[model samples]
Target: MNLYWHRRDLRGTDNRGLARAVSVSEGPVAPVFVFDPTVLEHAAPVRVACLLEALEGLRAWYRERGSDLLVVRGEASDAIPRLAAEYEADAVVWADDYSGLARERDRAVTAALEDDGVACESVHDSIHHEPGSITPNEGAHYSVFSYFWKKWRDREKREPLEPPAADALADVAGDPLPSRSELGFDKPTATPQSVTQAAARERTTEFCSGPIYRYADNRDKPAVDGTSRLSVHLKWGTIGIRKVYAATQRAAERATTDDDRESVAAFQRQLAWREFYAHVLAFNPETVTENFSGYEHPIPWRNDPDELAAWKAGETGYPIVDAGMRQLQAEGWIHNRVRMLVASFLTKDLLIDWREGYDWFRRNLADHETANDVGGWQWAGSTGTDAQPYFRVFNPMKQGREYDPDADYIREYIPELEGVPADAIHDWHDLDPDRRAQLAPSYPAPIVDHGERREGAIAAFEQARGE
Candidate 1:
């Protein structure tokens, strides 16, 4: 018998790891999922909530096929071996995870399985190409994304694998899943959307049907529901990467014009970006906490308790930045453009350390993937590969005016600005004290002067670079 261990890959459909387990098994394959405390040690309420939901969906999928996903809680090294012995499985297989902590746990689990004489394998099922597969002539991975995107775009991707046939699955019943409260987690503040295989397929079809054609044009406009809203699915692996890529390929074939084709390509480029960061994090795991690129001198970041508090509370007095933070609180998700904006507001404008932003995102974001979260925060702080240029500190006012032009997105999240005019909200910084008070007495004024802070942030980076 063979054991298929579930990690991030929750769905039964289009799962590479599960297919591999079925292919190698002489007898029926038994599926299992271990809630390793080592992994949960870093999880937040939002993440736990999504995990439980996905697990429930996966369990239902297995049960329908005359099998069950055995859900157990303990350190994987112990629980997996114990389950393997009990199930009498000779081999175990799972999908690979690239985070440093995940890798550490996998190493321990592999050693224990080996000691017990259980054959084990881990397949790269998350991203299209595994780490170190796409590389520059000199380095292990591309530091610049454009270079990586070129190769990733051209690579021949594998077709999505079918779910294991019912006869291939062992008819094993599993224990009841634990509730969030039983798992020692409070109900999440932000209510995330459903993360299930059905939901993933529905979203992909709905998005690729029409929205993708206008993606490049409307993606920057937060007011429009232009994005696929599939990040949570990808993060949880409710949908397979090949399934997503295949959907896009179908969308491309359905396109009627050059513009539509280019728009589809634009969205595909983002997929490439996701893999690029995974490759980077795989090679340099320390980049999760430290800067990917170093400077001659240390970056001089400020530490102001009140400012940090305001930023977290979504009261930063920057309409757009506050809107993004509040959106995160309300939804456990933020638009990609706003994510960069808020990160910039914290690191460059307030001059706080990027780690503060990273920590908060890791805790608050339901869709947070370690590689993407660290990459984004470091990029905003100008300490990552293809980091935002030091001289181009984001002007929150211009951003508000350009992206949220009518301030519709701002009003949707920040009710305090619901009555305020879009023009007044965008030009809040330029408005004098009396005008600001008259416009919105409840909402605070700009926390820091953007013009001054932008120059200060640039000077700090220049000093760090010894320029």
Candidate 2:
């Protein structure tokens, strides 16, 4: 018998590892998922709840085919080997994960399985390409995204695997799935609308069918529904990256005009960016804590608890910044452009450490991912490889006026600013004293002068870099 272990790749459809397990097995394949406490304890509550929802979906899918997902809870090393021995399984297969902790866990499980005479196989199903597959002439990982993107675009991506047939699964009785509270988390009442594979497929189809034609022009606008909104699904592996990439490629081919083609290309580039960050994380695992550039000098961070508190509360007095923060709290996700802006404000404007913001995001984001989160934070803090230059501070006021010119995104989250005029919302603090007084008392003024803080932040970076 063959055993297939499910990790982040929760979906039954187009799963490479499951297909491989079925292909190699002379007998039925027993699909199992173990809720590893070591990984779950450090995970975000919302994300854990989402994973449970996905698992329930997968369980239902398996049951419809007269099979069941063998759900277990404990250390994977012990549980997997025990389950394998009980089932008399000779081979175990699973999708590969690139994170440091995941790699370590896999090593332990693999060693234990080998000791029991069980072969372990890992399929790189989650990402379009494995980390080391695409590289420079030196055969090392590409630290620069442009070089990586060039190679990535030229490489051919394999077609997504078909879902396993009904007879492929073993008719094995399984334990009941656990609830959020049972897993040591508060019960999450609602599954976000975009949690399931059906929703993800529908969204991807809708995007490639229509919205993708305008993605180049509209993706950065926070108020517009221009994005694919597939990140959450991608995070949980509800939809395979291959399916999304294939769909977008088809869209690009079907393009009737140059503008349409440009839009499709732009959207595809975002996918490349996702892979790029994953590649960065795979190579520089220590980037989770240390700066990627290895700037040894200490950056003098502020000890203003009130400032940090206000930033987290979405009352930073910057409309754009507050709007993004509020969205994160309300929906467990935020716009990508606003994410960069908010990260800049935290590290540069507030003089707080990037790790602080990274922690908050790790705890709250429904799509929380360690690699992407670290890459983003380090980029904003100007400490990553190919980071945003430290001197080029993001002016929040300009950002609000530029991207959210109508102040629609701000008003949507910050209700207090709803009544304020679009122009005034972006510069409420700079208005005449009478005009400022006329605004609601509930709305606070800017926490710090941008011009003053800009110089101070630049000086701090220079000092740290020994310029």
Candidate 3:
């Protein structure tokens, strides 16, 4: 029997690693998942909650097939080799994970398995294209996304693999899965929507059915449920990338109008972006901590504890920024546009280190993926490849008026402004102290002058660049 080491790919259906295990196994494949303390150390409450839920869903799937997912707790190096000997497995198989720490873990596991005389196989199951598969002619990966996107779009994608047959799985039973508390994690402050494969599949079908057609128009408008909320699923590996892309293709085929077709393409573009960051991270793992495009001089980020705390508490008095931050606290997710805006606000307006924002999001977001999280923070901080230029700081007021025009998205999260007029809400930063008090006395005034900060941010960037 071959032992299938389940990592992020929690789902049985459309899993490449499981299929590979079955293919090579002489008998039914044994499956195991190790909750290593090393990995859990980097995890937060929200992500741990989601992980437990995803594991439960996976366990249910295995139980239905007369097999059980092995839930073990130990260092993978020790646990995996021991399991291989216990199961008397000839080989171990797993899906590829793209992060420096993950890569380190894999190396340790591989060495231990080899010492036990067991072979190993790791497949590229998560993303459609492997890191080195899509890249520039010279560099290991493309620094600019557009150049990468064109090649990624044109590259032929692989078909989604079918789940292993029930007969192909080992009939060994596993102990009852542990709860979040059992794993020493507190209850998540903000919970994510159901993160099972069922939820993911249903969401994909519903999104591709009609919402995809209006995605381009409604994606920027946070009030509308325009974009597919598939990030958490993708992060947890509840759904496969091939399946996501296939859904978009079907959506495009159903489109009757040019605009509808374009909308589908727009959503697909986001998928490409996800992969683009993955490739970039694979080649440049240090970019996670260090700037991808570093300046000659270090960025003079302000060490203002009060300002940072206010931003974290959604009390910075920037209405739109506050709403986005509050939405993260409430739902464990924020709209994509709002994510950029809040990130820009933190890195520019407050001049705080991007690492602070990245760490906060890492702990709070249920869908936090290392590559995407770091890439986005650096992009907003103007320290990433193909990122927004340093000179173009986002205007929170203009952004609020344009994206949340009716203040619907803002009001949905920030209830203090629920009764305030849309105009007054958008102009909250500009409103005088007495006028603001009269409108929404509960809400605080703007913490900093955005106009002054924008100019200051630009000058700071120029100084760092030595220009």
Error of 1 at 91 (Å): 0.4
Worst 10 residues of 2 by lDDT: 186-195
Candidate 3 Cα RMSD after full superposition onto the native fold (Å) = 0.7
Alpha-carbon RMSD, candidate 1: 0.8
lDDT of 1 by residue, 1-467 (tens): 99999999999989999999999999999999988878887899999999999999999999999999998999999999999999889899999999999998899999999999999999999999999999999989999999999999999999998888999999999999988888888999999999988999999999999999999998898888999999999999999999999999999999999999999999999999899999999999999989999999999988688899999999988999999999999999999999999999999899999999999999999999999999999999999999998778999999999999999999999887878899999998899989988878888988889999999999998999999
Q: Provide the lowest-lDDT 10-residue window in model 1.
A: 33-42
RMSD in angstroms, all models? 0.8, 1.4, 0.7
Q: lDDT of candidate 3? A: 0.93
lDDT tens string, model 3, 1-467?
A: 99999999999988999999999899999889999999999999999989989999999999999999998999999999999999999999999999999999999999999988999999999999999998688979999999998999999988878888899999998888778888889988896888999999999999999999999999999998888999999999999888999989989999999999999999999999999999988989998899999798999998599999999999999999999999899889999999999999999999999999999999899999999999999999999979999999999999999998999999998889879999999888888899999888899899999999988899889999998
Off by over 4 Å in 3: none
Q: What RMSD value applies to candidate 2?
A: 1.4
lDDT of 2 by residue, 1-467 (tens): 99999998888888999999999998999999999999987786778778888888888889999999999999999999999999999899999888898999999999999999999899899888889898878845877888888888888998977889989899988999988888888754224545887888899999999999999989989999999999889888889998998899899999999999999988888888888888888888888988888554788778478989989989888989999998888888989999999999999999899999999998888888788899899999999867999999999999999999999999999998868889899887587757756775687778887889888999988888887
Worst 10 residues of 3 by lDDT: 173-182
Question: What C-alpha lDDT do the candidate models reach, one value each?
Answer: 0.93, 0.88, 0.93
In candidate 3, position 138 carries an lDDT of 93
lDDT score of model 1?
0.93
